[model samples]
Target: MLAELIRRDVDDIVDEWEQFARSSIPAAEDLSPEDLRDHARLLLLAVAADLETVQGEAEQHEKSRGELPDNSPQITATAHEHAQHRFEQRFTLDQMLSEVRALRASVLRRWVEQNDRYDPDAVAELIRYGEAMDQALTESVAFFGAKVDQSRGLLLGVLGHDIRTPLGAVRMSAQLLERTKGLDERQSKAVQRILSSSDSMRSMVDELLDFTQTSLGMRLPISRVPSDLGSVCAEVLAELEALHPERDISLACEGDLSGQWDAGRVGQMLSNLVSNAIQHGNELPVTVTARAGAGDVSIAVHNKGRPVRPQSLATLFEPLAQAKDMGGDRHSGSSGLGLGLYIARQIAVAHGGSLEVVSSEQDGTTFTARLRR
Candidate 1:
C-alpha cells in the first residue's frame, strides 16, 4: 500500500512537470540557443531530483522489508549517473540554441499550413482553451500553496490549544498549594491530585502536539531495528492502566510476536486506541489483543459499548466527525476536537498499516490496527 501510494504521488508529480513544460515553451517562430539550453537543463535537473527522492524512499522501504535485490541500488545509481552524464555530454548551450531554432522553424511550418483557412470559431476555441489551461495552472499552484499555509496554521493553533489546558491546571494547582497551608490530609491529597493531573495534562498536550505534527505530513525518522510488538503492547497497557484504574484493561499476545516498526509510533498508535476505548467504551472492561503472522501484525482493542450506527461508521475517520451519541447520556464527556480516531488512522497509514472498526449489537466495537512486518 505504501509503495502504491508513493508511486501514485510520483506519477502526479511527473504529470504536473510535463504539463508545466508543455505550457512554458514560447509560441514564437524564432528562439535563442541559450534559452533552450537553460530551459532543458532546469527541467532535467528537477526531474532527476524528483526521481532520486522517490527511488531513495523506495529503496529504504525495500531494505526494511529485507527484499532489496543486490542489483537494485546499483541500477538506481546508474540511472542517475547516466542522467547527469547526458546533461553534461549531450548538449552545450550553443547546441541547445541550435536545437530550439530548428524546433521553432518546424513549428512555424506547421502553423503556416494550418493558418490558411482557419475558421473564426476554431480560432476562438483555441484561445478559450489556452485561457482555461492558464487559469487551471494558476489555480492548482494557488490551491497547493493555500493547503500548505492552512496546515501550518492548524499546527500552531492546535499547539496553543493543547498547551493552555495544562498551563491552566498548573497555575490553579500552585494557587491552591499556597492557600492551603494548614489544610487537613484530605485537602492536601486533593492538592496533590491536582498537581498530578496537571502533570498528566502536560504530557498529553505534548503527545497531542507531536501527533498533530506527524499527521500534518511531518515524516517520521524511523530506524529499521528489530522490535518486539509484545513489548510495545505491554508498555502501552501498563501506561493505560495507570491512567484509568477504574477500568480493567488486558493485553493478549498470541504466538510468536516480533516485527520491525518505529516503537514510539507503534506505542503512540496503541495509546490513542486505548485512550479512545476508555473515553468512548463506557466503564466496561477493555481488552487489547495482538497477533503476529509471517509478514504482518494486528492489534485489536475491544470494548463493550453500544454499537455504532451504520450511518455514522462511514465518516468515523473523517476530521471532526464523531460517532453519534448512542444514548443521550453516553459519550457526554467526549466534547473535544474529535481528532483521536483520525489521528490514529493517520498514524496507522504512516506505518504502512491501517485501522479498521467492527461493531454490532451482538458483540461490541473493536478497532484493529494492522501493520506490515
Candidate 2:
C-alpha cells in the first residue's frame, strides 16, 4: 500500500517535470538542433529526480514500518526494469540530443576558432544561453537534494527523541531498585547487574540522540573557560579505576596542562577514549598522558592491544562500528550503538580541536585529543 502511494508520488513529479520541460522548451517546427538538445537534457534531469524521490520514499517507508515491505522484492525487480527502460527510452534521447548540441556548437565555433569572416554576435548569444541552462539545471538539482536531506534528518531526530524518553525512565527506576535495603549478597549482585545494564542502555540511547541532533546541524552547548587538562585526565582515570579495579591504569602529566575548553565535554571525551582502550587493548598497563604547551594542549590514552585494521580505521569515528566486535573479541560484551568515538570527535570539532589514532603491533594503540590555543 505504501509502495503504491510512493509510486503515485513519483508519477506526479514526473508529470510536473514534463509540464516544466514543455513550457521551458517549446516544440517548434523549425527548432534548432541545440534547442532540441537542451530540452533533452532537461528531460533527463527530471527523470533522475523522479528516480531519487522514489528510492528515498521507499527507504523511508521501510524504516517507518520497522521491517521490509511486502513488495520490497517486487520493488527491487521493478527498479531493474526501470534501469533497462532508461537505456531504451531516456539514454537514447539524451545521446541524440547531446550529439545534436555538439554538432551545433562545433559548427558555430568554427567561426571563432578560425578567427575568420564569421560574425561574433551570434556565437556569443549561443554561449550565453548554454551557460544559463547549465546553471539552472545545476541549481535545481542541488535544491531538491538538500530538501530531501533535511526531511530525513528531521524524521530521524523525532524518532531518536521518542526512543530516549522511555529508556531514560527505565534507567532511573533501575537505579532506585539498587538502593533498596535488606537484599542478600546474591540478590544484591543481581540488582547491581540490572543497574549496570540499565546504565549501558541509557548511554546507548544518549549517543543515538546526540547523533541525530548533530545530523541536523545542532551544535553541543559547550562553555570555554580555563580548565586543567591534567585534572580532567585524572578524574576520568579515577572513574575507570573505580569501575575496573582489576585493571592497572595510570595517569601521567608532563606539564601543568592548563587550557581553555568545556570541562564537561573534555571529561566525556577522555572517559570514552580511556574506556575504549581498556576494553579493547591488551591486559598490559593502560596509560593516560597529558601535555601542555605554549599554544596548545594534548591528551592521549594509550593501551596495549592488537593493531586496528586499516579498513576499519577510517570508520572508527562512526557510531556503531566497534560496538559489536572490538578487534573480533566477541566476549567483550560491548553491544553499544557505537557513538563513543563519534561523540568524542564531534566534541573535539566543536572545541576547534581534533581527534586522531595511532596504532602498532608492538607499541599498541594511542588515541589523542588536541585542543588549539
Candidate 3:
C-alpha cells in the first residue's frame, strides 16, 4: 500500500529529496537542480516496484538482509545503474547513501500525513517497503564502490601515458646539450643531471603504468629475453654508484650468473632494493649478494641501520605504503612515491619469483629476490 502511496506522490517526494541533496552534499555545489536530485527518483521507483512484488515470508527475510538472490537483480538493476552514473558525477558514497535514506523517510512521512484512517495492514506494508528500499541501497553501494575503483584505474592509466611525452623530449634536449661544443664542465654536468632525471621519470612512469594495469585486474606484463643475471645486477649497481658516488656499495656474485629473464624488469627490481638500502642504511656500507643456483637465481641487498617497524614491514610491499619519516630523502634527492618495493615485488612475481624482506636491530634489513632461471 505504501509502494502505491509512493507512486501517487512521487513528484512531491522527489522535490523534498532534491532539497536535502542541495543542502547536505558539498559535491553538489556546482550541480543544477536536476543533477543535484541525481538517482533518487529512479531508485525510489525501483524500490516501489520491489515492494509491489508478492514476496513470501522466507523471501521477505532474505530481502531484509539484501540477499534475495532470485528477485534482487531485476528489482535493483536500475538503482545500481544510477549508482554508477552518480560516481562519474563525483557524488561521495556517504552522500549517495544519505539521499537514499532521505527518499525513504520522505515517502513514509508523506503517507502518514496524508491518510487519516490507518489500517492494520499498513504496518506490514511499511515493513516490506523498508526492506525493499534497503535492498536497493545495498545494490547501489556495491556498484558505487566498483565505479570508484574503475575511475582510479583509468586515471592512473591516463596519467602514466600522458607524462611520458614531455619526459622523452627533456631527455633528448639533455642529450643535445651534451653534444654542444661550447659547453663547459658545469654545463655538461647539468645536462647529465637532466638526463638522469629523465631516466628516473621514465622509471616512475613505467611503475605507475604497471600499478595501474594490475589495479585494473591485469598482470604486470614482461618480455623474457636472453640475458646475463650478473650483467643485469652489475649495470644496476653501476648506476647506483654513479648516482651516489660517496656511498659504499659492494656487490658479490657466486656461481654462473646468466639466465633467461626480463633484463629490464630484473634491473628495476635490483635498483629498487639497492636504492632502498642506501637510503635507509646510509651510515653503513650497502652489500649486494647475487648467486645462481642449479635452477634458480637469488639476489639480496643488505644494509645495517634501524630495523623496519613490524607494522610497516607487514605492508612494505603494498603500493603507496610508506612509513613516516622512513622515506626521509634519497641520494638522487627525489622523493620516493612509495611504489618502488611494491612494483619490484610485482615484477618478481611476474617472473615466477618472490621478493621478501627481513629486518632486525642485530642483523639489519635484507631484501631477497629469488627467480626461476
Best by lDDT: 3
Return the top candidate by TM-score.
Answer: 3
The whole-model lDDT of each prediction reads 0.60, 0.61, 0.82
In candidate 1, list every pair of residues with a backbone clash: 33-97
Candidate 3 lDDT over 265-306, as tens digits, reads 899899988888888894689999999889889999999967
Error of 3 at 235 (Å): 1.6
Q: Per-residue alpha-carbon lDDT of model 1 for 1-373, expressed as tens digits?
A: 2122223344443344334434553321133434324433333233233333333546545633545534233333433332333234433323323333433333234444546666775454333323222332233334444454555658765775767875896868667685866888988777777766665565456445655565566754455468998999999899778767788999899977787788887887788777777776768889999997777899999988788789889888875566656432423223355556777787678778899999898899899998888
Model 2 residue 101 CA deviation in Å: 22
- Give one clash count per candidate, in the order shown: 1, 3, 0
TM-score of each: 0.53, 0.59, 0.82
Model 1 has how many clashing residue pairs?
1
TM-score of 3: 0.82
Model 3 misplaced regions, further than 4 Å:
1-4, 19-41, 48-71, 89-95, 111-134, 325-327, 331-335
Query: Candidate 2 residues 113-187, lDDT tens each?
Result: 545443564444344333333333333334444555566677867776787778678767767877888878998
